[model samples]
Target: MFEKVLIANRGEIALRIHRACREMGIHTVAVHSTADADAMHVRLADESVCIGPPSARDSYLNIPAILSAATITGADAIHPGIGFMAENAQFAEMVEEHGFTFIGPTPEHIRIMGDKVTAKRTVQSLGMPCVPGSDGPLDTVEDALATAKRIGYPVLIKAAAGGGGKGMKVALGPEQLREAYQLARGEARGAFGNDQVYMEKYLAKPRHIEIQVLADTHGNAVHFGERDCSVQRRHQKVVEEGPSPALNAEQRAHIGGIAANVVRELGYRGVGTIEFLFEDGQFYFIEMNTRLQVEHTVTEMITGIDLVREQIRVAAGAPLGYGQDAIRFQGHSIECRINAEHPDTFMPSPGRIDGYHAPGGLGVRVDSALYDGYRIPPHYDSLIAKLVVHGASRNECLMRLRRALEEFVIGGVETSLPLHRRIISEPDFINGSYDIHWLEHLLGLKG
Candidate 1:
């Protein structure tokens, strides 16, 4: 076991990792920007180090400073909590090269799964179902048009190295292909510094489903299950639930088995998510997230597992000690990502939190670092908290989620609480009839 671990990110995830470390009798070193000197994770960690100013590029993403902090603290391992440097293959290699463990997948796996074009080919070769589209990155507008025609109308152009809906464009017909292709490439170049883009046959209504898998260095891999993240806005997940209402027992087992097998074959280590798009009873491989996901809480709730602790254990050369059959799935779980933003306008709301009250009672959990007087710095992501609830069934889980959302309160700054409340009450969401575009349609953003 590692004596000390350095957390290389901020917000609730950092605190989440800190709690897991404490439970395993490991000390933590919290590295933060100047603006987060008083952050809750920093306050709770065994030690804290200020790496840089308020800017994320100067602090959270500063590899040299983070490595220095870990060295000075004598930490044995580093946990790059979601975002920032979490999926950076270079960062993972550097950490191992500098004689510290990276509590995630191998750098080789990260590199293979980082680019969309390569990921699609790799997964397809692994016998996973994939959406029909261009075999590789399109070289020109003519190539894109040819691929779009072959794939039929309404094709989606995506960046080879893109995420969070950036570097993505849709064209409904041949006439719109050139503009959408150029725009997608431009966005790709601006966001990821890579102009490479690929094409896919766009499905009008598809549910965003992902399988959560964990593997050990000892050739053992198991999948917790699937999460239905269909309720999205601009490709950002809002509400996530386990044992998707759309899938039956057979479908769940089939996909889950495939995911576990893939990771085992690839020699993957640590936690990773294999994302897919489900439409018309078929599942299409989209991409893989190499690090821990923000919605991991819901999976943990459904399956009695401490993913962070497992990640740490695997990094320390511990075997899983069990197989897939030993794993059991329990009740249904739901998670609402409460961002510090307006519910209606969807604008960032970062400021001092005057008063805060988290909901309580059985089957309700709120993961947050907010305090009564904590000032939310405007420099980082606006996600302030995660409200996760579990129950015996999906219906019971929704009811519990509704009550938890109503009981929760964060004063002084607007939040998306109201929006979540509205979503839970909607008939589509109540009956699990929503898709990836459902939220945008509900918000009148889509026609």
Candidate 2:
């Protein structure tokens, strides 16, 4: 067992990992940027090192600094918590080469799944259903037109790297395809430093469902069920839930098997998610996130499993604690991302929090990186906190969530709490028949 593990990220996830390490009796070395000097993770960890300045580029994302911290602290492993160097393949390889456990999948798995094009192809080879699209990178307008004709309209042109809805465009015709292709390519190149763009048949009113899969080096794999991430704005998921209200028992079982099959076939390890777009009763693979997702808490809330701890155990070559048949899922879980942004205008709102009181009592969990007087840093993600609630049933969960949101008293900066309140009250959302455009449609911002 590793005596000490270096954490290569910050904020709520970092603290979450620290708590898990404390339980496992593993010492933690936290790396923080200058701006995060007073961060909770720093104070909680066994040891901490200031990597660099306020900017993430000079600090949290600095490879050498993080590696140096791990070496100096005598950490046997490095755990990248959802950001910074989490999915960087080169960094993963470097850590292993330096005799430190990466605490995730192999570098080959990360590299293959990091690129959208390669990931789609690999999943397709594993016999997973994917949305019809281009075969590979399209260089010319002519190349795009040929692919679009085969794919049919309307199609989505997306960057072959990165998510969060950046470098993506939807086109309905040849002229629009040619025009949008260059723009998407340029955006992809600028955003991810890779101009590789691919195509997919765009689904209208599709539900975003993802299955959580965990695999061990011993070839044991099982799924924890699915999360409904249909509540999104600007292509980024704002809210998520486990045991999707829309899924039937049979459908859930089918999808869960598909996710486990992919992991076993790919020789992947650790916790990963297989995201899919469901339209009309058909499921199409979107992409696989090779790291723990922001919505992982919802799954944990439903399944009673600590995914982060499981990742560490997997890296240690431990066999899965539970077998496929032993894994049971119950109840319904929901998570609302409380970002420091205006509910309507969606602009960043960063400042010191005034009154910071979270809802408690029963079935409510709030994961946040804030406290009284903790400055909401303007340099990073605007997400101030996460509100998760679970219930005996979906309806009961919604009722509890609505009440919990009412009790949360966050002051100083604007938040998405009101937005969450509005969503739970809406008839469409409550019906669980919502699609990707549900949020924008509810807000009257159809783009």
What lDDT does the true structure give each of the candidates?
0.95, 0.90
Clashes of each: 0, 0
Estimate TM-scores for all models: 0.99, 0.98
Model 2, CA-based lDDT: 0.90
Per-residue lDDT of model 1, residues 338-443, tens digit only? 9999999989999999989999899999999999999999999999999999999999999999999989989999999999999999999999999999999999
Candidate 2: misplaced stretches above 4 Å?
Answer: none
306-343 per-residue lDDT for model 2 (tens digits): 99999999998898978878877889999999999999
